[model samples]
Target: MKKILKYTLASLIAISLANCTSDFEDINTDPNGISNESLTQMNNHIGGSFTPMFLNVFNVTPAWNFQLQQNLLGDVYSGYMTPPTPFAGNVNNMTYSLVDGWNGFPWSDAYGSVMPFALDIKNAVALGGDASGEKFVHLANIIRVTAMHRVSDIYGPIRYTKFDDFETTGEYDSQSEAYQAFFTELGTAIDELKAFEDDAQFAPFDMSSLGGDIAMWRKFANSLRLRLAMRVVKVDPALASAEGEKSLSSDAGFLEATDMYINTGFAHPLTVISGSWGDVRMGAEMESILEGFDDGRKEVYFNPAEDPALAGAYKGIRMGIEIEAKGQYGAHSSIGSVVDSETMQWMSAAEVYFLRAEAALRGWSNAGTAQEHYENGVRASFGQHGVSGVDAYLADNVSTPNDFVDALNATNDIAYPSDVTIAYNTSGTNEEQLEQIITQKWIAMFPDGQEAWSEFRRTGYPRIFPVVVNNSGGTIDTDVQIRRINFVENEVNTNGDNVAIAVGYLNGPDNGGTRLWWDIDGSNF
Candidate 1:
């Protein structure tokens, strides 16, 4: 894979302006420092743009970038992991202080690395006048939605639909509007790619687990549609059901047997953050749930604690607690061999099964019964990790998440938030059944904390622990938890006028406490 060049703030602004301009020649002039004429040598004009889109979806290189882009926010908020280091003298994102400097990466990385390349593919294909090449545009759209939806989830309103329009270059889409656009784009991609299912033109540039098989790309698009469809179920149930059923009934199928992984040509970032730097460790919630369930995958996800007091135990640290130094909890479990490779998982077949399970719970058309899909989700996850005893694990109904015990500090420990059991709750309430499905989904989609955090906000399942110390100055509530991240400083500085208007689209003030459009604070039923 070609190295993705790092862009400074000025170049990123230049690229954004360049994208909005109407001149075709100006749009083709690569702002990424690659000459379009140079890229035409081997169809690299279109193919070359794909690598960055895949890499930036969940950045793998420059561990610090990934730390800021995901690990600091979603990974901590979702209860998957937390940093041992008390950044800024113990007042940081983990404590809800909402650092603007660190929070900007998710927005910047997506805009700089993902959106431009996708737009470039669309323009390059159109300028080439080869109708067959439209397939590349569709593929780029699928990847774009995959990346952009996470951005919209992070910050409620984003510059999406009107991004290419010169007049509305800095306009923002409300989360609802952005999601509607996602469904439309994903639907179009799934439909158009049907013609190119057997086309191998994408093989040379393919950096994903799909291996450039257009059929598999179609399946990924379909599965992604289901994900976005489920996301809006609370805010727009009718639209959710419509899109959900469409994906369920699509002939393109879903990610049933295989997972979607991007083979980033660089080392996985977690190896550096958790292993080399000792900056991140397992979270308290992970310890409670995995130990309570006697989950076999725990060993696969993290190594035993290195602290002499808890040696050989799978210990983890509680989030948002005061600590003078990293050494206090630095010896807690670090990440294991799961991220030892170059590939970063984007979506998994196990995740699709859980999505279908939720669709079934909601009575959507064509989805299998909740129990079957739920069990399949669990089994699929076990298979993905090559763990054994899945059948017994699935049948154990009495097991519940254990109470969290902070090894170094008893003050930070807490009881497990819920009594959600392992077995499928065949005779439970809709809320209970929903929790079962989502909790399993949460476990299945480990390490990909961006989606996990989004689902937690949407459904309130898996019962993540609240912060031990909220430093939000009352902007964020202790019990309510953080709903969404504030808009980045870069947007406010560069597109202040449009961002001022976008904040009005949010349900409340532009802070972490504001619930997004789909994060309705009500019953799932």
Candidate 2:
């Protein structure tokens, strides 16, 4: 991990130098004239550092990087999408073979692209001693929490709190510890930014849909706090309640009207992956629920299958099935035009509503009611996608997910897991009501498989079908599903001792089967 940190900084410095080499040659004719202070004026150093951090959160460039960073992992695991192509002759992530080479992207992308830039901003601000600049650090902290939390969720323990210390940079914090830090940092950022709520310094560096509005960033932070708070309700109910209530009471408010999206200034990666490369397609679970409910957003989320046999119906492939070649499923649904823009969605207004819905279901303070929040989540999603017929869609309680049928292979088909309905179940049990909320949340949070996957592991709702094939060699259970990706090979090779200790923090072995600190077994309630 020390090497990892060094490489991160070295890479950042290389990029910085590469961008300014001509300026350096011209300005540094007299070496003494070019001081570190002088270089600060060369560009908006502090503000410029933020671009990579924001972009790397989802890794928008070079499509394949995004493919590994998220698509192959969270997107598939959440049952939102699957790749039609089978690399390694089908013994890949979908089959639970655990591709170490491919799995390292999530880790490397964060450490390489996100963490160093954030730390650079923090250090640059502190060294400058500008009280006005302190706001930048707070903002960076919020983004850090936003990006690193996903990394932490992917791998149980990560080097987070003490990452700045070179000597102990390799030491790992358990997921619980890292999550606690996330809450603390988010709370501090939210509170401190109140004084700078009207400050426009962040505007220039703002790549998100909020347009550098400090108040909106505070809302995003507060909403993020709410999300992390809800994540731990089952494991640490008291702390979860305290933090959740704090977020609810904050004047910064929650993401209600507009969703948070980062303008990466590149074509949406899914356009390439699903459209050009023919790699990814819609998942079976999406077809079951969306089609069964007669969801208006179904067309918004996916294109109809081009296979002439399916007669242009919206179709998706079941994951982890035997695939001799991509052609068998290549004509299935590709991604819809919703992601045809340059922006990558971070958090949806609908997701925040669904989080509130879960908080209400858990009987947290200030949470109005589960049904209200649940329905609002649906409406928000409907509005987000320009879908109509919400009233009729919400009234139909009899509709449940349709059983899946593989267009090419009967062996890959399965029954829809539950009788959960489109309408909120007021008379249902706590677990049943939770299923309804999470199922809706799952539907609403399309393409954001990272959060969706985490929610699925936490609450066990919207029951995903078991894989059609198991290839974990008994290390992972087909019924239990893949818990977390194995610790990356780079960590194992470069930071062996620390990685060993990190594995000890897991509930089981250091494999895809092991549950993280929050992924406890049994009832969500």
Candidate 3:
């Protein structure tokens, strides 16, 4: 990582134009575009490429794009939220009918924004010098894994390892293969960064809350390794243990007291979409689960519904109902003030504790007792939300997720499927313990529906409610629900050959019905 002085996009062009004064009129090319001098500017180096990649992963502007990229798909499917408006006549993603146009954002946004910038950083560094560029390349690798894993989780297969060259630029790797690549990349990054632990090259470009500390970045990489390792525990137990233990054994600590959030200089997308625009509302499951647990954080997570008929209680809407218009559910609980802050969450410390809890239940080395981790996870979440009384809440042990009742439409309501309680059940079976850990994790990771949705597909815990309507045109089963989004239509149109090969990598049809590689649709025990 080279220390490059930050320059504005305008200044870079100004300098290039100032230098080319003699030949400026002869060459009628825009100097602001990727001109030789513009590309060679100090700001265009390894550090420069990161801002674009970081910002794009959780895109800030064009709120509608963020809505499609995450809110509508993962957020709704994970049982964390439900859209108030009846999109496409109530036959859209909420109803299991895949929307080609809406489903394309996550794919297009990643490739169009995050992926290309990551590749540019790698290329820009490699073309300069190997020794000097190695650190930058490793940093780029960490960012790549962070962004691409979500993309792979969405579509089952993605162009990752083979994205370097023109000949194989359009190639795709199956989810399993991509996970392996991610582990390998993390391993390399952790190892290399340890040697350069005192390096200050990363300071100039640091936008993370960690402030470009190499040691902290090393810890982040290790923590990420643990996360990915646990993601595959069900599908490949041995590999999961090996990778997970490596993380536990490392001196680079996991994210414990602090979380990973970037200061993006904008309001959280959820605030704009839910609070300002009134497009999203609380999910019925949220209302049921929080009320059942008597969770105090609910006050911070959601606002009291405006529907006077409900007497100012927190209410949520169910997915896939006959919504005539947005106004029908506009008065329902919109996202609360917690999301109005000006930062985007990449990961949470509470989530790490829950992950450790699951790893402990699996009898992994260095994970500590399952009960301890589970309680800590709850405490971390409570602290994160500035709520007190965690000890009393954790001790009750009597509360269970309440049966969901949709006041708007009782026909769509469902009873609580499981009786799992909050207190740590030390004598319970492995399956019971796993469910407790996952369910707590699901709650702590509110608003981050991508990871929650992936966990739901893999573990089948916490019992997410199924959609009331099945509108997949005989392609998706309502019980299993939508597993993963189909390959983006843009890829199919421009890269048909690769898309065909990618579809073959899927376990089932290349639609929302298909599960990804790590999402084994069976018992973990």
Candidate 4:
């Protein structure tokens, strides 16, 4: 990207971090209390960098940024949501036009807010003695990996594993290289963090739902490792299985029973985007599966349809369709109050269970039976949402994904392609079992569309609706759909050479048609 813009953004982030200085007014006679400068002087700068990174990843402010970075693109693409507004005369992302203006937010936000902060933390902690500050370094590494992996998932290649070197900072790592770095970083963090299991240095800087519990952070890190390992199972099964078994057997265990979340002081952006502004509503796939299973979590996930024509029913819009204005489908089911709450889910325990379920299907050691893990995943999700009747739902073997209907366009409708049910079929083939695991995992991971989108690209479970319009100018196939986002315009303008090299890493032209390194095209099973 532009060096000047990057430098300017870093300066702004430093100023923001300065404002987060801790209040120091204990027995110290200096009543003026510790100034921001003193906080940095006292080695508190390392922890200070974390607040901005955590808060900005799933950006808590200027709700429109979140709309562009995640809600509009991943949310729609993953079949979790669709927008009502006909942005730019309905030829936007919902219609597969790939809006250049909006597509840059995820990249810009990562490099501008998250990566810079993470770098500052690593640098600050590294300045201290290696043995003394190892814990802080590990913590920073964990946070860095957590934030950057999402960026790598968005656009195939990203500035990672080389961000610290000025000469190579602007260069990109291919998605596979980035994933390897993530594994390395997580491994380092997990190994070093175990040495400081009793340490509370992170507690003061902790703003996440983990609440400064270093052990819980370890659990989160291991769970993240498992999630990433599973992503590569199809592309590199041996490595995937090895990493998966390591995570499952780690002393710092997976995110079992409780998931990871961040309690940003502000209301979730979805509350504002989907509830207040009505810019987004439920996607048709969500409506089909949730309504089909008669899942009790539907009430927790969405409000009743507001359109008078479909009164009291849960309804959603198709991805790409002609719309004159937001008022057209704005009255459809609004996002439920669950997302509008105080915290944003980072990873769900339900997802961890499903990941283990897949590992079990692959016959990985310590993963338990697939059926047991699958049932636990569903039950865990129900408990997470405070929905009752899990036993009844798990026992019902007949419910299948209902056929999706577009009330506005008949051609947009499609039949339910799979007969996978909520109950586990012990005698089912590996492919059948895998689909069942992923489909529910898809449901359990609702509203966190980025992960869901990545898994969908990897496995093709819980079949999502194809866009009704092909606005890609023939770059992206209507059936295959958009695989990866093209590198943003900012990179083209300033880092043109590096962006071109990054395109070389892609399997096809630098467009939505190109698949990422881990996104194999054939059956995962």
- Which residue pairs collide in model 1, if any? none
- Candidate 2 lDDT over residue span 12-51, tens digit each: 6667656643354544455445555545443367778899
Report backbone clashes per prediction: 0, 0, 0, 0
- Runs of candidate 3 with Cα error greater than 4 angstroms are 1-44
lDDT (Cα, 0-100) at 34 in candidate 1: 35
User: Which regions in candidate 4 have their CA more than 4 angstroms from the true location?
Assistant: 1-43
For 75-103, candidate 4 gives per-residue lDDT tens digits of 89999999988989888887778998999
Candidate achieving the largest TM-score: 2
RMSD, every candidate, angstroms: 5.1, 3.6, 6.4, 4.0
- Residue-by-residue lDDT tens digits, candidate 1, 334-444: 998889888899999999999999999999999989999999989999999999999999999999999998887889989997999999988999999999999999999
lDDT of 3 at 390: 98
Return the clash pairs for model 4, or none.
none
Candidate 4 residue 26 C-alpha distance from true site, Å: 22
**lDDT of each candidate versus the true structure:** 0.88, 0.88, 0.82, 0.84
Q: Give the TM-score of candidate 4.
A: 0.93
> What's the distance in Å from true for residue 24, model 3?
21
Q: Alpha carbon lDDT of residue 230, candidate 4?
A: 94
Residues 1-525 of candidate 3: C-alpha lDDT, one tens digit per residue: 001111222244345345423343322354333345533353345566788777877777778888989999888888888989888888899988889999888887887667666766665544443354578778878888888898888888998887665557688898899999999999989988888788877787877877778888888888899999988988899999999999989888888888888788877889889978899999988888888888898898899999998798888887877788888888999898778787888888999999888888888999998899999999999999999999998998799988988767778788979888899999999899999899889999988888889889889977888777888887888888788899888778777888899999998888888778998877887
